[model samples]
Target: MASAVKDSRSGYGTLLRTPGAWTFLLPGFLARQPFAMLTIGIVLLVQSTTGSYGTAGAVSATTGVAMALFAPQGGKLADRFGQRAVLLPGVLVHAAGVAALITLALAHAPLWALLAVAVPTGASTPQVGPMVRARWAARLGAGPLMPTAAAFESVTDEFTFVVGPVLATALCTGIHPAAGLVAEAALTLAGGLLFAAQKRSQPAVHRPGSGERPRVSALSVPGVRVLIVAFLGIGAVFGGMQVSLTAFTQHIGQPGINGVLYGIFAGGNMLAGIACGAITWKVGPRRRLLVAYGLLALATTPLWAVTAVPLLGAVGLVVGLCIAPALITGYTLVETLVPATARTEAFTWLTGAVALGQAAAATSAGQLADGFGPSTGFLVPLAGTALACTVLLALRAHLLPRRSAGGAEAAAGHLPAQVSAGAEDRERELARA
Candidate 1:
């Protein structure tokens, strides 16, 4: 049924016609304002207070690790108790942690206080990404609307990264070192609360006290394991690329514009993501996903040979075009595979998988760059993408099953009734089409 979702009307304008789509997307945008700023803001905040970049890096990493480890738990809470219930408390805890961190920095408190608070800050992250994606899946069901929403979120991600770090850097240096962190806390509270208020769109939660463990965890589902692992590889590609791109720019003596070039790369993906959503895709989601991964694997290899800056930028654009499509398709596949009851957790695991891959690849690429050169570091993303392609290839039958009764069962999953209604609606819509 997911594979059957197609659109002859080829434009983003159609998506806005869904009633209250803007209501959901706008606050979702607001909810993300603090996330991009947090890591850099933490780094700057700690460094300013402690005069130790190492400590700053450590604290930031601690926050990230805590966030990663707890994300699934947060998702589980959202599944058991509605999104609003989970998000409201997350809003408070996250804001308080950030506020405490800022106050400690200003007060010149000990490093341990800063480190301790970072855990709650990360743990209490509102999980806006997963929540919003789940909401889209619930509202639109397994149709082109699914991919469009995914692409829109992907585009939003690009926009945040492009502007977020710049804004954080400016606030930290221009105002006070604590300014970005303060702003981050304020935005977190405002955005989180606003988003929670939109309770009408929230996905139905699994009831409490019916309390046998779920028949299948998100990871236990067929094809989900491969999805998580493939995402890990994709994440590594990103992490490795970040390090390699930095190295390449410095090699060319244009270290100053590394961010500019990265932005161009992201811009290419942003446009491609939108195009991928707007078109009527005849190819199955699995094929499109595999093709995108294969393209990324091939596109990144030339980075090892190219020495010119402009050529590198051009190649980066090519590589960038493949990423969002892969991500958009991946989310679509996950929607088809995961039962709606476990949806948020399934998506959170996907995010965690990527985070893990990025961390490992970033470390490896940094080492290779230090040992050999920056261009050599390019091998990391190339290798990562190849692995992703390999994983997708291995899971092809499971991930992209044929259109038969078995396929319908796989796509229908064991979703709860409230969630399954959306799937049935999509099927009826497809029949009309």
Candidate 2:
């Protein structure tokens, strides 16, 4: 047991030890906080100023939709030009947009005006998470370390979600209504600039050579499409749990416990992410993704029936624990299935899909909770994951890339130099086993 524990942890130790890894990772973490903070910050500030949750939600939804639509375009540009070129301008525009939105909100500007500024704010939000993943792929390549990196990033994402909302809420309530947006803008500007400046670690831009095929959109790949839908289901689980937990607490006459219950759920996700990163997996990522997703479906199946708070918390934690493996495995498959050139774009697609899905689920779940009950609201996640799992199982073949004349997938050679080295290392490890 001790040997297994040490083996599980060694992957992260070695991954973090990679030379120059910290340069971008630190700033990336700082920059990513705004993603978690943005929607909640907007909702809080707008609700305080306008005195209507409906209006605030509309404005926030506008921002989310704009971000979801434009993030992939930014990723494509990053792949074509370079991360620095895109990120520098993106961060600046986002900061300026945030400033404008805050000012307009304080002045009690028209809803249309706030919505207009929101477009730029969200559209210009830096694609920091996807860019960081691209850096890891460039630095570590298609190797065992890549899975560890994906797990670490997933953990980071879960952490930001856990922290960001709390921070935003505190700033909006304790400090000033605009404090959350102000802090979000400041982080975006500072962290994004620092991250963008790390040119040494950025993926090399892969412009087509003469007579080569023109670069295509990442969505053209069937596998990317499948993964996007799968991610959407994961997002639904998040949205559903948030609403259902809040309603459950309110229903039980202990509204304050909503935060605690939700914390337990998200904490489980973070712990699972840490553990998933530590273990050295023998099973391939494709199999892991399917199994993890199925388990997620199974775990969520009982949510609608739980009446006791303790049982609810226990079930929510188990559901949270099931999420990380699916998320990490899905990301690992991206490294193998997509070419290096379009990888950042592919990551952004998945990220955006999650955002879109979360927004939709939250809206629908909120309605179900309001109209029917908290228990009915819990159905959204179960329905979402089960439906997505069906699609994933039906289209599982698209997950694997086609082999080319050179006896490797077309994407195999397009990867970084470290990929071939990692393949060789895998062969040695297998032989030893």
Candidate 3:
């Protein structure tokens, strides 16, 4: 049993050893950090200049909404064109937009001007996370290493969330209100350019003569739509926690403890992501996703009733632990349910769903905390997951790949010929690893 466990954990090491993997992985990490930093940086700078949290949140929401709306489109373009073609101009535009936003905030410009610039700032943000996942798919195909890669990427994402806000907060508070944005812009430009230059790692573009069928929107896939809804619920958990934890700390008269509480939650997520990537499971990703999400809902149920700090921290840790498995499994399912051609767009859609869900939950939870109490805010996570769990139960069949008359996997549209062969055995092997 111990030997099996060690073998399972070695999967990540095997995946990282893929030649040329580090070239893109390093730049991708740097580029993806901006996604976690942008909203917080904007909030800090705008609040410092205007002395209004309300105004600051509004600007940040504008950025989030814009990013959610436009990210899939960017992914679609990258699919039809190439990652470099889209990302090169995207990083430049994003940098300019961030500069404009910082300049406007410092000049005390009207909310309208800030909103205008926020659109481009968010829309032009490089789709590095999705692009990186697409690269993993292209490089690894439908192999055992794919799942490990997904888990690794989730761990990377969790780490960024942990680090990005802290770094942004420190820069804005300790250095200058504009320092966070400045650092964010610099990272986006440098990291994005470096990531884009790795053409060998980028997924092949599906042009007319590339022998690929005309690209379709990833949303057309039934499974992709279902996953989006599931992800939205997951986003609610994050958003609810952010607001509720703050309100809870304030309610307890130790508002400063909010950061520490949230850190415990995020830390659990990172640890779980690492462990999840290390251990090979015997269950299929579809089954694992359902089970993980159910556990997530169950974990969140007790949150509204907890008041003590230590107890809250423990529950938060459990809830965070539940999150990474569901997330990693969901991304793994995308490989089986979406075609290679639209995989990047599918990834972006799931990511966008999470952002949109988080924004909505934060807004609703904040209002609830203000009207009722922090405990009421905690209800958002439970409600979100419960509602999503219901949908997942009702339409769980959609999560499976479609098989054709010959008993071959259809996988939404179609996978590359090489990936289609023996896909099930590979998936089962991945599960057992």
Candidate 4:
């Protein structure tokens, strides 16, 4: 029975067998809903009310920067205290900020008022991505199945991205501009609180409580910086694509349907991530990363000519295919790079880098879209992909770990739930040492 489950296509069956999986995974998915909705919501709301794309972009950028600057500290706090300690308060603050933003936007508040409220709002993001992944890592150690789990999670994330924007737009266009953010505020409170409450699956907080030798920090590692920078470049691609797509939709006089097009963009990622989970990967992380980067560069360049909605959606689908697999590989690499103790913080740092890149791209791309045109803004994503490809090629070796990550995991006594005979020998040796 176990073997049959393990051999099942996609490995989701095996992944979900962990105790209390659904209890937490459901809320985690809901918490991630805002990841896609909030930005687009802000963009649409501020643009419509204030009649300034540049201001809209600037506000989004402020939120991104605030989130970027505080994410690591949030993770640090979670590591030191506990997930509940950090997350419970974080969610409420975030909900309040979103509510305030919506009310102020509807009232047509001053730009400075909106921007000031947005800073704290963005900073209040509850560290959803890292915390959820950390829970999975704790439940299923870093091993073969870990890849499948990451892939599945990536697929879920893609689905959230697909639905979030569509849902946000529906509420905004169907109901009111402020309605989308109202929903966001509700989800942040409900989903975040529920997710944090699932304490059973939460990873054990790792902190120096006493005179125990301090665990090695992820930042001190050599290759980690490179990986973070790589994530930054990738985030730039996403940020530019998002901002440009918004401009493109508005330019085409179909701003309401942009959500469907964006959803299609994520639909491809959802499909690819599902397939990626079903198959066992033979390629190492470094090689897979380069190939993914190559695909991103190739796929995004044609987006330059995407004047029509269908062409843009098709091209968006193509580019979307590369995102999930690349993110999966990056997650796997970051997990392997850090010690088990620092996994949450390490993961959040990757998000921080991505947020930072998104901030820069959104700010600049919005200006480009507003002044030069949406066509010019599209160049940012293509340029970002090209630069990321270049960086990955130049620093491939430097970004790779010096030692075997699997072996290190074994040495740390963090083997998977099921170990093959070949792995058993290594596990035994590590045990003896």
TM-score of each: 0.79, 0.86, 0.87, 0.90
Off by over 4 Å in 2: 1-10, 49-54, 104-111, 243-259, 304-311, 369-376, 407-433
Model 1 error, position 187 (Å) = 2.8
lDDT, residue 81, model 2: 97
Give me the candidate number with maximum lDDT: 3
Two-way lDDT contest, 1 vs 4, winner = 4
What is the per-residue lDDT of model 2 for residues 158-177, given as tens digits with 9 covering 90 to 100? 88877776677668767898
Off by over 4 Å in 3: 1-10, 47-54, 106-110, 210-212, 246-257, 373-375, 405-433
- In terms of lDDT, model 2 sits at 0.80
Q: Candidate 3's residue-wise lDDT over 196-309, tens digit each?
A: 999998988766556634666789889999999999999888777876775676578875566567778878889999999988675666667888999999999999999889
lDDT tens readout by residue for model 4, 1-433: 0111122234788788877889888999989888777877888788889877788888888888898888988877777677889999899999999988988988999889999999989899877888888888887775556777878888887898889888987887788877778888888898899898888888887656586557666677666777777778777776787788878888888887778887888888889888888876554555667788788878888886778788888998998898877877788776556666777788888888777778778878899988998877778777877887787777766554444445554344333323333333432343333
Q: Between which residue pairs do clashes occur in model 4?
A: none
lDDT of 1 by residue, 62-139 (tens): 676677678888888888788888889988999899988888888988878888988898888777888888888778
Worst lDDT run of 10 residues, candidate 3, spans: 1-10
Q: How far is candidate 4 from the true structure (C-alpha RMSD, Å)?
A: 5.5
Give each model's whole-structure lDDT. 0.73, 0.80, 0.82, 0.77
Winner by lDDT between candidate 3 and candidate 2: 3
Alpha-carbon lDDT of model 4: 0.77
Candidate 3: what lDDT? 0.82
